[model samples]
Every structure is written in structure tokens, then in C-alpha cells.
Target: MKIQNKKTCIAVLILVTIEQVIKIVINNNFLDKKFPILPGFLYFEPMFNRDYSWFNSMFQLGVSKWIHIVFGAIMIILVYLFYQYLNYQFGTIKIVNIMYAFIFSGAMCSLIDKIFWNGSLDYILVNGFFTFDLKDVYINIFSGLIILSVLLKNKVLNQIDDNIVKDFTKYILRKL
Candidate 1:
């Protein structure tokens, strides 16, 4: 495998591990408790959603269970295709690879939870908005990045590659 392939694999593994760790912590400690983080703005409200996939809520498709099963399968396949697209479009862009990795791993996490637990685990609540969890956060970030990557052209993506890690590291080192 190439070096980029190895980095991509490591990125996916790290993302999936982080998601699972967060899920385990939420499952253990916040199942029945509601911890308000910002009074009326943000909250830790553990909730399980069983009846539908996340898109169904957004699209309000009211799809049947069989359809949801098919949707899940298709999503897993799309994760593969998305990785291929990323590899072809920006092979050496580590940030793009990492974003796609998170997207795939986050989808896998939610799919596993839906299959085994009869629902996707959602907990964090935003005022006047939906309740979701770390997996959802990963998905949303990936979705936004996908949009930006597609719309903003390669220079923006390259800037992200150049600046994000360096700026983040500088901030962390400054704090340290």
C-alpha cells in the first residue's frame, strides 16, 4: 500500500475508535439522566431513535423498515465510492482523506448501533433543534466539508491541508 493509503486507514481506525469510546461513555452514564450544559441551549439528553434513519427525519420519507435496511446498505457502499472519489480527486490531501474517513466511520458507527441496539443513540440536545451525538457530529462535519470541498475548488482544500493542522498545533503548543 502507498503511504497515503496507510494514513487513510489509520485515520479511519482512529475516528471509529473515538466514536465508539464516546458512545460507550454516553451509554453507560447518560442513559436516563439529562445533564444541562448551557441552561437552555445545550444539553446531554440521552435518547434512542428506533423508527427511522437520520435522513428519514430530515426528508420525512417515512420509509419502511425494509427500505431503511436497503438505505443502510447503500450508504455503506457510498462510503466506498466516496473514498474512491477522494483518492482520485485529492490523493495526497491528508485533510480530505481524514474527512472522508470520518464520514465513512461515522456512518458505520450509526449503522452498527441501529442494527444491534434497534436505534441510533442520540444524546446531545441543542435548544430548538434536534438531539444527536458524537457520531452525528462527525457526520455533519463531514457533510459540511464535502460541500465545501466540492464548491470551493482545490485551492481552498489545499489551504485547509496547509493551515488546519499547523494552526491547531500552534494553538495547542501556545496553550501548553
Candidate 2:
């Protein structure tokens, strides 16, 4: 494997391990305990989320575990394909790699949660909002980096055009 591939793998592994460790610690030690981080705002309240997401819960989708697992796998594949497209277009960019790593790690952790933990072990709670975990943070970091990259007008992104989109779509369709 290339060095970049190794780095991405290691980064993903480290991220996934961090999330799993936190989940385990929360599950074992603070399952029933709630520690307020900010009064009336934030708290550490561990809960097992069986649903796929807040959207599913809000809409009462009642999606099954297998569906979540399959969707997670599909998302991982799509993200990897998109990352490959970005690399092909921009060459090996460190920031893009980091962004890919974060999103990939989050997707991987979500998959692991679904397959092994039977759901996400969300620990952080926002009053009147929802509970989340480290995986969510990883994904959010990716989102923020994307916004920053756009705001900074990355060269790779600046070169984007209709032809690139068409070509990328062709490439993905071929791969599929």
C-alpha cells in the first residue's frame, strides 16, 4: 500500500479506537449517572441509540438494525469513492486527506456501533436537543473543514467545472 493509504488507515483506526474506548468507559462507569457539564445545557448522559438517527426517531421510522448496518456500509463506500475522485482531481492534498480520514472514521465507528454495540453509545447530551458521541464529532469536524476549504477557495475546488462533474459521474458509474 502507498504511504498515504497507510496514514489514512492508521488515522481511521486511531479515531475508531478513541470512540470505542469512550463508549466502553461510558457504558461501564456512567450508564445510569448524569454529570452536568454546563448547568441546564450540557451533560454526560450515556444512552444506547437503537435508531439510525434523530431523523428516524423523530419521524418514527423504526428502522431495523440490519438496515442501519447496510446503510452505513453503503455510505462508507460512497465516501471512499468521493475521496478517490478528489484525489484524482487534486493529487494528494493533506487537508483533503485529513477531511477524508475524519469522515471515514466517523462512518466506520457508526458501522462498528451498529454491528457490535447493537447501536450507537451516545453519551453527550444537550438539554432539549439530542445526545451524541465522538463519532458525531469526527463527522462534524469533516463538515467544518469542508466549509473552511470552500471559504479559503482551495485550488482543487476552484478548478471544479461541469466537465469534472461529468467525468466524475462517469467514473463512479463505471466503478458501480
Candidate 3:
């Protein structure tokens, strides 16, 4: 890897570190109650999820951790392959770099939660229709941004229509 590649890795590492730091701060500072800024708008509170059983709750804690590790490894490998493909095709580091940042940020966030706090921490509730936390917001927004970026970057436009061209030629012949 070149210098830029090393820098990119460092950037992703920084993102992971920042995520862990945020988690630590939240877990250590606030454990009492929710801090409601708006009455029905938003609330900040610390919530812990001990069981890492989103779909299945039967398995033990060790099993849950293994599930995450296996999933994370697979996911990281896929991301790496996709990133290489994108970078090679486009000859630009923009998309891959953005993807790296988001993927690492998400991975570190969830990984730390599972390792330290048992499950994931549910904090920073959103008001109005539903409730959410910082981790949820980060994950959702990051995913949306990635999808939008990929769509915009790889969008195909100015497609030639053979039928339209043929029809135009026939119309000109009739006019002549």
C-alpha cells in the first residue's frame, strides 16, 4: 500500500476510536435518567441491552459474541472487496474512502457495545413518532449516505434509444 492507502487506514482507525470514546463517555457519565430537552421532541438517556439477541434469545452470551465476530469478519471482507472494485474502476479514492469511514465507524460502534456493555446501548431517544439512540442514528444516516453516494456516482445517463433514432429517420424519409 502507498502513503495514501496508509492514511486512509488511519482515517478509518480514527473513526473507530472516536466511536468507542463516545460510547465510553455515555456509559460512564449518565446512568441515572433521561435528559429531556424538548417535552415531546428529544430525550438523552443511557440504556443498556444485556442480551445480544435481536432475533433469537435462546443462545448464550458467548454464542452471541461469536455470531457478531463471524458476521463482522464476513462483512469487513465484503466491504474490502467492494472497495477495491470501486476504487479500481473509478480510479478515484472518494467513494471507497467514504465507505471505509462509515463501515469502520459502524463496526467499531457495535463491536464496542457488545464487548463492554454486554449488548448495545440505547441512548438519545427521538420524539414525535418513535424513539432512537445515537448508535441507531449513526447507523441509519451512514447507510443512507452510502446508498445515495453510490447511486449518484454510478448512475447511467444519456442512454441512446435505437427505436427513437429509427423512428426519426423514417419520419425524415416520409417528409422528403
* lDDT of every model, 2 decimals: 0.72, 0.86, 0.60
| 41: Cα error in model 2, Å | 1.2
| TM values, all candidates | 0.73, 0.90, 0.66
Stretches of candidate 1 off by over 4 Å are 1-4, 58-62, 85-90, 150-152, 155-176
Query: After aligning candidate 3 to the native by TM-score, how far in Å is the CA of 102 from where it should be?
Result: 0.9
* TM-score for candidate 2, residues paired by index: 0.90
- lDDT string, candidate 3, 1-176, tens digits: 23236666887677777766776787777767677877677787666656553444344434567677667666665556545544543454664576566765666666666767678776666674444444555567668866786667643111224554465445446535
The residue ranges of model 2 lying beyond 4 angstroms of the native Cα positions read: 1-3, 163-165, 173-176
- The lDDT-based order of candidates, best leading, equals 2, 1, 3
**Residues 61-112 of candidate 2: C-alpha lDDT, one tens digit per residue:** 9988898888889999878887888776677888888998999999999899
Superposition error at 119 for model 2 (Å): 1.3
lDDT at 144, model 1: 85
C-alpha-based local distance difference test score of model 1: 0.72
Model 1, 50-142: lDDT tens digits are 765767777778777667667787887756654554455445576567676778777777777766666777888898888887777888888
Q: Number of the top candidate by lDDT?
A: 2
Clashes of each: 0, 0, 0
Pairs clashing within candidate 1: none
